[model samples]
Target: MKKYIQSYLGLHLIFLIIAMILFLPLLLNGELVTWRDSQFHIARFHELIMAQQNGHFFPDIIKYSGTNSWGYGLNFFYPTYLFYPLIFLWRLTKLPVTSILIFDIIVVYFALWSNFAIVYKITSKIKLAFTFALTYVLTAAIGNAILDNVAVVRIAYMTQYASNIVILLAPVVVLSFYNIIFLHDNRTWLRAAIYSSFAVMLSIPTTLGIVLTVLCMVVVAYFKRQLSINNMNQLLRSVLLTLGLSAAFVFPFIEQRLANNWANLPNNPDLFGANFSTVLMRIFNLSNVLSLLIIGLTALLIFYKKFNYVYKILGLSYIVALLFLYSNLFPWYLFNRELSGALQMTYRWHFMPAILGSLFVAFAVTDLMKIKQKMLPIVSVMLIYLSFNGMMLNTVAKIAMLMVLIMQRTILLHLTRIILKPIHCLA
Candidate 1:
């Protein structure tokens, strides 16, 4: 009990420091940081409010363009349940948009904390958990989809999309994979099922991304004789539950696809056209040092040793991630019309592999430390720095840094209530 207490409080203290640093710029500033999609997200939030006020009772379609011709569009099909809690808050109290925005940021903090918990559960190591969570929270999650598209999800204040990645997407992939691979007891299946059902609401693209990654993982684990019938059963149950829960949104998507609503969705060469033969060169030349280190460490688990099924699964997952990341390199478009169109934007599947890569790195780092490798801490630090603010060449990066420095020094700025509210909640 004492040890657990110390660990929990210590985690909160660490989290507090990081949170303060992250919030410092916003605290000093008088306005919100409107990144690429930030302003558009704010408009969507207002549209959500409008839909709710009309007594729609948790609307599926959010049509703000007033263009009935856009025909219910993404607002109807796309998932926005991540914002539902804010909607509930609006109903309970007349909270203004600024307050809601602040809460959105706070929710992001909470979700990142949850991410740490997932890592801790996997590795059973404190430092490893903190490092993984810190690396992910501070950095751009992997270069999922495209590097620039990363900002649309992880940053730029698209709260729901961001929440989907770190909060729901990360946990769903890692937790379910761990449970399926290690735990054989029936006692845990019910809890797993409920979680699987609930979290599938994050979004279809991300859900499918994880699902596909796990499917490949399951096959790999089984062929290697690491997974038994019971383990496969557990995995299947969770997957079925996820599909069942997401059917509300997913079925509609399937129907539209069947009607060829996506027939015109082209596999644009400019967007994803990279040859498979060039991936090796890209890895050597253009990959992040952190990701390279991650792949190296995990690969060592497979090549340098034998029968390390855990690392084997992770190794296969890394390959799976790369495959989806560069899916346009394949000839899938020549056959399977539905699949080709559904997977037209293969980079979207990068979400699952990103979480998998994070897990592999976290696990690999912890394992290396166990072996007392030299300079490991320095390596981890370098990776942490690189993972941050994905696009370094952009003007937004310069402006964001300038804003943070300005706000960090302006400690006595005119913002007591905004800062104090979260502090009070933390206390």
Candidate 2:
């Protein structure tokens, strides 16, 4: 029991340390950085704080704090329950900016923990789990949410979209689903439903993304002959419960749509085109090391034969489906036209790839570390150089530098084995 407690504390301490390292710039600067949607998030946060202070516990109308105090029923349309933690901190600190910063740290730490938990559950290797978790967190997918310091030059911000919630809870949802289906653990079905409900509450697009991911895993499992009658039954139960638990948001969301006049709706052909273009650009761009690493390793995992069933199903096939959905190849035009109200933007699909891609990259790295080939050291060095280059070029300097240092230590240790091999051979 003491050993268990010590191990748990040590693992979480590492997660906390890494999260703080990622946030070092913002913490030192003592200010919240805005990018793309952050300003809108800040506005909504202010409105919530105002509403709470005014004694309207459940605000029906968002007080337009900046203008003539007009009210809009945004809370009815969008879920703000996920931000309650930040709100609680805001109430305690009475410092909105500090509240956001603290909230970001909390999100990052949990995200790391979730990623670590998923990887560790699969591999049962502490070192591999930590490495994969760290790599997963450093990717551009997650950087879009919490890594939006002044140092990061990318159009990074996901608060209004609540991708941070996706980042924190997606892995948990995936892990629970994995347990239910692959492990045949009926106990995890409810856990999967609960986490999936929270994910959908934050973003319906997240719900779609997770469902698609689970479908991919389900397909892979079926093909592998690992899926069974019990697995299918458990999956059905979990999905049903997920829908039931999410009814709170789903019912109102549907009612609002049904009651409202639908004569006019959003039409953005250019935005649809831009989404495809953005995915291509982000993938090909040399500065985006995280995306490139994910893309590269995902391709490798799909082709690489050595990865176990979990890595192949969870990492390879899932990522392929996600990238396919994100690509121009997917019939986004027809899909969007049919269900225009369902998704605000198509790029929301990137959430899953950013997440699952990280898992695959960790899988690739872990497998590479296990190989006995001496040339592996040279390969590791090249990867380190490219990763370092990506970090420096992309302006995620401080966080990247810390990650690079850790990678360097690991790679250099492997390189030393190569260096000593000649000496031992000579002896």
Candidate 3:
């Protein structure tokens, strides 16, 4: 028991140390880096707290009589889900905004850690798990999206911060799903419920993606005969519990908002109008660069029949996501606009498949290494080095590190065969 505890602590310590180092640049500049969306989220949180202090249970929307009677807006309501915990902390210790910013970093770190641990448990390979976790958290796309719109341009709004929180929670969602599906542990059912509920409360956009993924997993499990009666009962109960808990907070605001005209609510058009050619181009563009290496690797694994049942299920989920991306109905768009009204944006929907594709690739690479006798350690080292360097540096440095990763993978295969022949004979 002591040994197990020690092992867990050792692993967590390593993850924390690496995560902190990777996030150091952002931590140093995060306070100064104020995006409009982030500012909006912070403002909303402050507004809610102020309203609470004034003995109001809900945020009072200020309306100008005989002018713009825009009705009571729920813009301030979004952050309440994230702010409640912070408010508790603030009540215990009267810290300023700086403390909240620090708290955000800590929360993000734990989110990343939980995400990586979940991936590791699935793949049972430390190197691949670490690589996927690091990449997911610090992906160039995420950085580009955040830095381009939020940090440099000073767009302070709720979406930016909310998206970050969503990204952090994504792993938790995936992990919970993995636990319930593959491990079949009863504890995982409760965990999945809690995590999924928190995910929905954090950002409806991310939660929408997660729901679709869950649906796909459920369908696949049912078809594959993997869903036992016990598992099905657990899943249903968990979903019900999550919904009931969330409704306690969500129903009042939803009722209030829906009392106003739901049809004429804000609509986002950017999600629609992407033609087949454009969708193909986007997929191709991701593939041309090494960005979609994981996607390619997943395909290769499926082709070779190397993937296990669990991996096959995840792989099918990715395929379903792709099909949805191309479908005429644009289910993601409909779901997003329906749930959050003006809050749903189209371009961000790609994040769902991107994460799943990366996980698939990680699994494929690890499985490939297992089959190829001698290349495992070499490729593992390369991934570790690249993950560290990639996290610490910016564009040019990251590019160089990625190139090194590719070259190492190529050379290690040949080196493995040559080195293992003599050792095999001696053995």
Candidate 4:
């Protein structure tokens, strides 16, 4: 036992150190970095605190919240299972906002640690695992989807929404589904089911993501001829377990929405008449150069003569994920019209590529590092470019900047090598 613990101690220590560094502002400054939906989420946390104090452990209506204090059913409509830890911390500390902030930092750490541990479990390479984990956690910042100054821009700001939970558990779901389907690992299906349940409990957008992620995994398994009766049975067991586990939220949410005639929430999808360029822009902003690297790696893994089963699965999953991302652009929607309405924007599918693409880049970069050390200069330039190019910039501007970046001597040379001998570069 002692030997086992010592062997894994480095990962734990690295997680803690990086977490503290990332969360320094929230901890030392004693404040949250406010952004889109921050106020609404803070109020949700406050309602939880209020409900607990009023002796309503699981209040259907938060009488202390809503317009004119008429009692809001926010808790009834949205699952708060993910926030129980925050509530517990609030009870212990008696500091409502502080407790929420602390819990936010904790969740960030959990997200980082989970991604790191899972990649390591699959690859058994500490450097590769840490690179993937760190980049995945900070993808938003790396892509300039959030602020440039902050290292963890999205995480620093978006702590209030349960969407964070969806992001946190996405990698786990992907990996478990891969294990159950491709490896015939029946034991992992239950784990996948439980995490999928947790993910779906959050909201419609999250449920869509979890369901689609599993579907993509299964589809890829089938495409590769890895799908089997046992795989199907394991998947069935996973679905049943997921439904049973999520019933607490599923049943009540359905009941309340139906009883109150709130079933038809406005979807208001913005992609109805969006042109090709517009859709491309959305995908481009989804992860910037990370998306390019993923596309490159996935192609190599899928088409290369020497097949890599693990990466091929990841590649197929990314391809399927792209279909969903582009589904909104189609004349007829791919998902149920009603369900598609739940996603205000089609880019909600970004979570899928975010996880898979980061893993792809991790595999690519780690291999490149081993094979040709000289390519490090181009990788550095691309990383620098990603940091400076904000997501809000126009598509043309981003492309222009990228073209300029590619014109650099080192990057230009690397691009040539990549085009000429992509397999050699990756392998």
- Candidate that scores best on TM-score: 4
Task: Tell me the TM-score of each prediction against the true structure.
Answer: 0.66, 0.71, 0.67, 0.72
lDDT of 1 by residue, 217-315 (tens): 667777878889788777678668767866776676556545633223234544353567444432432333435656567566655453267767876
Each prediction's number of clashing residue pairs: 1, 0, 9, 1
Q: Candidates' lDDT values, in order?
A: 0.53, 0.60, 0.55, 0.61
**Maximum-lDDT candidate:** 4
**lDDT tens string, model 4, 383-403?**
434432321222544465455
Ranking by lDDT: 4, 2, 3, 1
All models, RMSD in angstroms: 14.0, 11.0, 11.3, 9.1
Task: Decide which is better by TM-score, 2 or 4.
Answer: 4
TM-score of 4: 0.72
Q: List the residue pairs that clash in candidate 3.
A: 35-155, 35-156, 36-155, 36-156, 36-157, 37-155, 37-156, 37-157, 38-157
Better of 2 and 3 by lDDT: 2
Count of backbone collisions within predicted model 2: 0
